[model samples]
Target: MADDSDLPQVVNRPGGATVGEQFRELLEARELIGFLAVRDLKSRYKQTVFGLAWAVLQPLIGAAVFLVLMTRVVGVDTDPVPYLLYVFVGFVAWTYFQASFTSASEVFTRNTDLITKVYFARLASPIAALVPGLVSVVVGLAVLVPMLLAYQRSPGWPIVTLPLWLLALFVATLGPALMASALLVRYRDLRQVVGLGLQTMLFVTPVVYDASGIEGGVRWLYYANPLAGVLAGLRWSTIAAAGPPTEAALSLGVAVVLVAVGMFVFRRFERTFADVI
Candidate 1:
């Protein structure tokens, strides 16, 4: 209410570029992320009779069911590799990515207290959900050892390359997780869409059937799925599948694009999170 003569003109606020700053903030908040992850893991089993065994059970059941459906019922040829073993390997990897990314997408909406108060890496929530799944995947891999022994499958030199395969998987999976998490802040409908999309993707990705089952221009569609390379690379590394390198490269390239697009889109809207979310 100062007199017009004495009043100063109003000025616009400078829009902030906080992506870098936020990343640093996230680094600092790493411990919080770990705690949240551990808490989630604990809460997951709190009421259950079996506890963490439930994690092992899910993929095992899925693998067994798919193995029966694809091999026994459908009579599909799995090539030099046993169909069940091969599909099991791919299923574990794909399940991890799907679970991690889907949970990541819902992070912001899932934890209101964490987002609203006490500044921490906003990205940590989704990253945290990834932990139990990672633990489950590791244990799941261990369980596969006895199965491998039972099947007379031998671990090969290619197994040494698993770390590289996993790195690609992580980056590829994380892109969608982050992208979905950020968008859910504004569009809750995406939550259900992600669930349905993952289901559709599973049928399309050649998890149960060999990539060879697909024909012509449609074959490229499987390669085009970002996870095709991940599933293929995982199978190649673990089971000696020797899938196409060019197609794997294409999958990695698509993953890179998804991550780049996710980061750009997430950053652009991230500032509005505190206000809208």
Candidate 2:
């Protein structure tokens, strides 16, 4: 029998990993990634009476509240489509982005012990954090289908573009998530700021209202929010609403740039995460 003590140890040198090397490491750690994702899913639903129902319930409840407040009370217009269906689609996409961003932002701080003790790729944490939210979004969609059917509406041919729209959403959120997670290692107060920012962003986005309502210079500023384009594209894809294709395309381009910059920033700072955490 071979002695365990005879095994050679691996050493990781500081600033030794290039972007390619890091991605290779991430690929090699795919099993760990899946495990962490499953762990997150189990931990989130563990001991909860509702379990996965919470995913569907949350958006359903929100849609109900907004349906009353926007349609019945305030009378916000969602012409050509039922108000409930319109807002529900927005909620589905928004909920996914919000949850993914929030989870990714706290990936490092939440798993301080694991990062400090383990030798896995640091990127895996944020990447794995995305899985639970993706699951929730899919579950939310199951609830959405019945609502659409009840309203006598269908997503139409545009629905084929859904995968592309989802990819854009992921890219848009990943940039911010990477930046936030990197900063969180050194600044704990950022968690609160991130929460507040997401709340503020909800109103600014076209989640409850139409982007077409904002005209002139103000409209340009509104489209500046990367999520604006993502939500608009999603709404167009799912409900066939009159979303601004040109603006969505431009914003998606911006999101790609943000992803590049964020990756640079994350990789630059990742070497220091072990010490900071």
Candidate 3:
């Protein structure tokens, strides 16, 4: 028999990868990400009779509830944009944020088998969860495209800045996702806390209502919240209206700070993940 030991081995590596090297390695692992993403999609809607319809249906239902509350109960003013569009934009953005956070928190725990056996980057687990949410966000955006066209609303030059806004949103939400996922390995209660906190934040955020609706001390607190910029940008993009510039800037700045801290924390804790998780 030929000496098989001479064959070049493709051993999988894990952490200690520089950010740039991690990204390149991640790109090389695209097939793994795709497989996990498809598995997640299938598992999420698996037993449900509605299947993929759950994607559109869940957000639509959420928007309807918000529309009723904003228009009837609170009587919040929506500028040129219809209440449906206003709520839909916030709901969709928030959905992506919340989904990313919750999914990321359990990444290490859920992928223990793969992590224990595989040679791929540990970052892949959290990154893979993002794929399903990204698909949902794109599908959700497509649903809005027709509505915008029907309304004859022109997004104007302001729409060009969307890429920046999206980057801000990604980091704002992803900070918590990375932080929470890393922490959850040690403290499981963090997951429940994150879930409840996100729910509370939804009411406080300018999602169903405009920022003008907040007043007094509450207004300052809202501006301090990292989600303020993302929510404002979502409204600006879909409604073609500008939010309070100063508050939006502050919010975006805070999000950047949070992301920095989150990155530091995640890196610090990552070494122990294999042991704890």
Candidate 4:
């Protein structure tokens, strides 16, 4: 046999990575992704007194606040459905998007040590960050179901489309999350910018107010926000509210585009992550 030392060795550069290869790598590393997700979930609530109950509590508290401010104080019209039901639905959907995006944006920086030491797909980190929020969404929905029953309301056939709206929400959130995380590796200050931006987004997303409240050019402007469609579609699906279906469909298209652009940006910048971060 030839000497082992005489054999040639090949090395691949991270910079030359393609989306297909990265996606395949992510698929191959699914078990590790699941482990990271579970680790994050456990770590998040490890010492907390309420544990997972915090997930249910957060949306409940937000719904309560919006119920008071929107119904009692501001007198926003929810029409057929009670303001409580409408606002609660909004809170549940918004909470998931908010929590998932926030965690994903920090996935890279928060796990710098792991990224530097491991040879796994970096996309796993952001994808894993989505798990806790998804768990929370389930918890929140459990709470919502009882409230819907208490209100003597049923979601009707439109509820069947709930999964589609959720997928759109995920795409909308993932795009921004990936873009932010990629940029954040180079500019640490983006963390605060993201926080402030999310706060601003909450107001524009129709969480507490109905999309119909705005008209003229302003309504179209609001419709332009991808999240506006998600919240509209979610409300339409769950509470049978007259959500702007056309606007929401357009927003879904926007979300798909955002996902493509986000992946492109992420793939372009990911090669430098290990070196710069």
Candidate 5:
């Protein structure tokens, strides 16, 4: 996987390139993107005792802890739905986001040697950063089916929209991910900030609790966070829970804006990445 013989050496000079052209470089460098993604996946799991098991186990353990705390101690009410099942679905989605985001944020810093020496579209770095997390999310979903059956639950009609939900989540994640990855090229401390921000984001995003649980005007908080609607959509498509939140549209808009800003910011600094790094 470390082999870069086939990797494109095309320099990604920002110059007067429009944002669309710079972003399009991501598509144009498809082979390089795939190569980087595979290299990243190998790098992440290489030489580990448990290897990829860490990906599966990390979310499982997180869900179990949340289940105990939310179910036994706090007694978070999911009603006919078992708290474990409810939380696991949410955990899987969060794991995808957090894992992808953390990796994307560090793409530049971690690939200093490559960026400083080679010539390839840096956008490939962020796009590649996103691929490996899907391994965990897909495995989590496979594990979810049996639990759903044990609970005598199924995904229902909304399951057909699962891919759509995943696409939306991916698009939404691209916002911070691109911004974080691009900014970290210059501000190395941003690595620590991205981790802390995501940690604080979990509680606010409703991963361990249902979005519907929040009532009254305060509910606006849920709609304000982009992850809320994406998570809600994931739950709706996977678990066939209550329909998506009333303000799901608002969250989607927020996500779109984040992506736009992230791209703008990333491009603004793109020309300087190689020299600065």
Candidate 6:
């Protein structure tokens, strides 16, 4: 038998870790993230009878309802991009945002067993929360191109930029998610507040309508939301004829600031999770 002195030593850092340390842990714990992501997928969909089909249907059903409303009741205008495709793309992108937010909020609350018992990369939980719904988003986008062909529409030259827009969507989502997850560990009530905030964000994000439809002076405010730019990019990438992403610079700037602030808040709160959580 090996002597206790010869055993591997695990460094214990209470409170929280530094940024570089956190990054290293996250990199080292990529497998943990994958495992957590799979667990999330199972708990979210597989446990249910319909399984992942529910994931696919939820967005489609919501989009269908909104499509009827936007085209009929409100008579909303989304020129160049067909109203059908516009609503579908917007719903798909928004679904991932909603999922990421909810998942992030529960990162600690859902894993109290692990958080209290073991030492691993706490950061991985929030990052993994962003993954499970991504499959639905990918499926939605893949389905869109075929829909366009069915409708006799062309994706045009803008299709090449689709990857950038998809990347932007994940970028826009990750920071807020991490921040939300950390905050929830201390303030569980924030779950409802954050959920309400997301609902407000959905209406504000031009998902059911176009930014051009808004009044000019206040349109800049709408562009300040990073998801607005991302949503615009998604629309443009898939529709080709859709309007350019307005105020692209301002939205990108806001996204960077959001990421910085979220990281700051998350790091500040993470140190106390094992205690208060």
Candidate 1: regions farther than 4 A off: 1-14, 213-218
* Model 5 vs. true fold: TM: 0.90
Please report the candidate that would top TM-score against the real structure: 4
lDDT of the structure predicted as candidate 5: 0.83
lDDT of 3 by residue, 2-35 (tens): 8979885453356554666666777888888888
Q: How does candidate 6 score on lDDT?
A: 0.82
Worst 10 residues of 6 by lDDT: 8-17
TM-score of each: 0.88, 0.91, 0.82, 0.91, 0.90, 0.91
Lowest lDDT 10-residue stretch of candidate 5: 8-17
Task: Note the residue pairs that clash in candidate 4.
Answer: none
Clashes of 1: 1
Candidate 6's residue-wise lDDT over 96-119, tens digit each?
Answer: 899777877787898897789997
In candidate 4, what are the lDDT values of residues 4-82, reduced to their tens digit? 7877543477465666777888898899889999998999899789998999899899999988887788898889878
Model 2 CA deviation exceeding 4 Å by range: 1-14
- Angstrom error of the Cα, residue 119, model 5: value is 1.6
* Model 1 alpha-carbon miss at residue 254, Å: 1.1
Candidate 1 or 2, higher TM-score? 2
lDDT, candidates in the order shown: 0.78, 0.82, 0.76, 0.83, 0.83, 0.82
Q: How many residue pairs of model 5 clash at the backbone?
A: 0
Local error of candidate 4 at residue 151 (angstroms): 1.5
